[model samples]
Target: MNYLELDTPALLIDREIMEKNCKDMQDYADREDVALRPHTKTHKMSKLALFQENMGAKGITVAKVGEGEVMASKGLKDIFIANEIVGEIKLRRVRELAKDIDISFGLDSILQAKMVEVAFEGAEKKARVLIEIEVGEERSGVVTEERFTELLDFLKQCSNIELLGVFSHDGHSYGAKDQEECRIINLEAQRRTLQFAELARKKGFLISRISIGSTPSMIFNFPILKGITEIRPGTYIFMDASQANAYGNFTRNAATILSTVISIPTEQRVIIDVGAKGLTTQRRTKGFTATKGLGRIKDWSGVALENVFDEHGILNHQKFHDAVQVGDKIEIIPNHICPVVNLHETAYLISDGKVIEKIPVDCRGKLK
Candidate 1:
């Protein structure tokens, strides 16, 4: 089937570009001597996760227990929930998952550890975990050295849990003003994570995995840092407009929404079939890159997705008067691909205008 025949507002993945993105990251990890555990949240599909494994990813990382459960159900053995899974119901589910596969999650607080301990107490296998260390992201994880030591001590008392190592995300690197600042952020983030790992090892804990990654940081600073066991990068698999803006290259963006111009409402404005529903409202942040408006128009350079309704996307550009007309098709490189992917049921794999395969968004709506 031809890509144009697939209807409007369709999510398309370019086969060539997607394969290169996965292989390039894997090769970089191989050269750096670090494990590449590509985060599954971006694509949210078991086939893509399995494709990463086939390309030499050490494991796969998911943001929630539900995502992990979906991956595990597809026979993915090694999985990491890179977010804190708290509450009795969540922890009980985590324990049940651990019974079948090598399951672990991020830990930043003692309250979370206590809950995990209770969830797995007297079980045959303990819940494996990686203590999250704050590394300038300030989103989650233990920040101070005092909090780090205290959390380790608390985990020692938890008979139903086993500490795997440490993990950190230099998410702030994404907001870096330039490559120089991104390099600095990545270095500091890794340094702080390693310091916490060393402290845990000194405290008689077996520190095995020292993981750190954010696509912006990893792309700029791989093979520079040593002693890091794994790097978990999610967005690299499907480069988005924001990533291309920060990292400089839209050519690597494999995922895009194939939208068609439905109406030329005015000389300066055109409406596309996709809206905020298909192309998420996320935009490129200041200091990251200089992409104006909401999303980048793939075929039209100066054009942008100026605004969106639930069902209609507004494209306004002075050039729209001659560059596009009613019923003309255009592809939109989303400001963010992760959320945009979740909004779709299936993604059509395309190659040179031909539809190669249809892949389900298997983990779509797994928000538990």
Candidate 2:
């Protein structure tokens, strides 16, 4: 019944902390009039996705079709794939899901739209679509208004596709100089989505949703400006070391990797059981909150453990290393929680140090 008894290298979630985090974000979104559609890519658990929906989330945001398939099987009514969905097989799968749920995904160009149009030709329903605007994050999406307009026209002519709305991820905010930069990124993202939505409306295209979000930036999106309809932030549900460093320590980030001290190589060096396989080396952070190591030691705050091995983590903390031993258990607040979650099959939901429930990482490895 206790999470400690479960096993080593286990994914642990503090239920109370997770609940508080969700509710707090929901409340913030409600106050701002922005629909909270938390991203399910971080947890990769449909149960957690449903949990977000139950906590005032309008829907869940997924990054891949494989993830959408897993969630749809669990009866999730609405989902938006925030990333571009390509490939014929993947598109056909998307069409198949359109028959069951309110499915939509990101589009950057008409060529991608053409691929979808062909895939949905024989489908029983049309695909819901959203044009992802590149507000600041240089990942994907139409970066200019002209390009945005071009993509809209392309999708509008499609018989099998319906233009639902426009969305943007203010991911660039994470690298800002201060909270002001975060606000500017989100504000500009909202402005871009709204601008495109207005243009589409004027052009006689039906634009119903105007979405904008980022976990670090959404914390400042409370004053809901006009035209912003939805907020899809995934990290708010489970805070990580990077997020904690970005948003401050008050955030309710409840998930962490519970590892064991495998060896005390020396007084200044220690090895943890968790390695690249369990915790990834994704240091996709920005600004002063950027992390130099693979992850931070949760039990020992402020210790960013570096020198990650394939099967071991080399921590360079003299006092911290001296305090740990070969068999002592330690919790890691990973640099990036998303990948760490994908490596685990399940998370031990803990309350008061006891395992209350075991939830599968249902959407884990849904990279297709």
Candidate 3:
């Protein structure tokens, strides 16, 4: 079946592109001598996760507990809940998952360790917890070696939680001015992550993984230190507009929102079926190139998605609008693909306009 026959506002994945992106990123990680734990949150499709595993990813990473459960149910042996899984219900679920697979998660506070300890005290199995060190993301994790050491000490007391290792996300490395700056930030992030690992080792901890990297930091930038064992990059598999603008160039941007020109409301403007709900509202920040709104018209590369209503996207370029008409299908390259994918049920896997398979977003809204 031809994927183009599908209705508007449908999510589509170029299978060839997705496979290439997976292989390329895994190759990079292998060449750098680091374990590749591709984050599954980007696509939320277990099929894609398995593809990553098939392409040489050491393990897979999910952002939520539900996603972790879904992957584990599908026989994914090594899974990491990269976010803190707090609360009795979530911790118990993580512990349950650990019984079958190698389960691990991020830890930034003693409160989290205490929660995990209490959750699995009677179960005889303990979950490995990676103490996240803040390397500039400021989103989650311990900021100082003292805080991480204290967290490790607390974990030692808890018979139900094992100290996995140290991990950090150099998200700030995305803001680097050039490739040189990006590389500097990458090395520095590894440097900071290694420092925390050394402290843990000195404290008699069986520190295993010295993991660090975000797609923006890891793709173009290389780390100098061999102490870093694993590289965790999510966005490299599906480059978006913002990642493209930040990470040198977004050559592997496999994912895009395919929309249709529904109406020519005016002579200088045409409306598309994809709006904020379909394409998401993410945009790029400062860069040498320009990016705006939810998406850009693929036919007209220079034309940006000028205006977005609740269910309509308006492209207001005179040269671009003249060629478009009612009932015409057009491709829209989304600014960000993650959330854009989450809003859909099944993304059609396509190759040369042929529908290969309809992959379910199995982890959609699995927030619990």
Tell me each candidate's TM-score.
Answer: 0.98, 0.96, 0.95
Off by over 4 Å in 1: none
Q: Model 2: runs farther than 4 Å from truth?
A: none
Model 2 lDDT, residue 63, Cα:
92
Q: Tens digits of per-residue lDDT for model 3 on 26-62?
A: 8788787888998888899898898889889998999
**Looking at candidate 3, what is the lDDT of residue 185?**
76
Instruction: Indicate the worst ten consecutive residues by lDDT in candidate 3.
Output: 284-293
Error of 2 at 201 (Å): 1.2
lDDT of 3: 0.81
Best-fitting candidate, scored by TM-score: 1
lDDT of model 2, residue 241: 79
What's the ranking of the predictions by lDDT, best on top?
1, 2, 3
Q: Give the TM-score of candidate 1.
A: 0.98
Residue pairs in candidate 2 whose N, alpha carbon or C atoms collide under 3 angstroms: 239-253
Candidate 1 clashes between residue pairs 3 or more apart in a chain or in different chains: none
Worst 10 residues of 1 by lDDT: 218-227
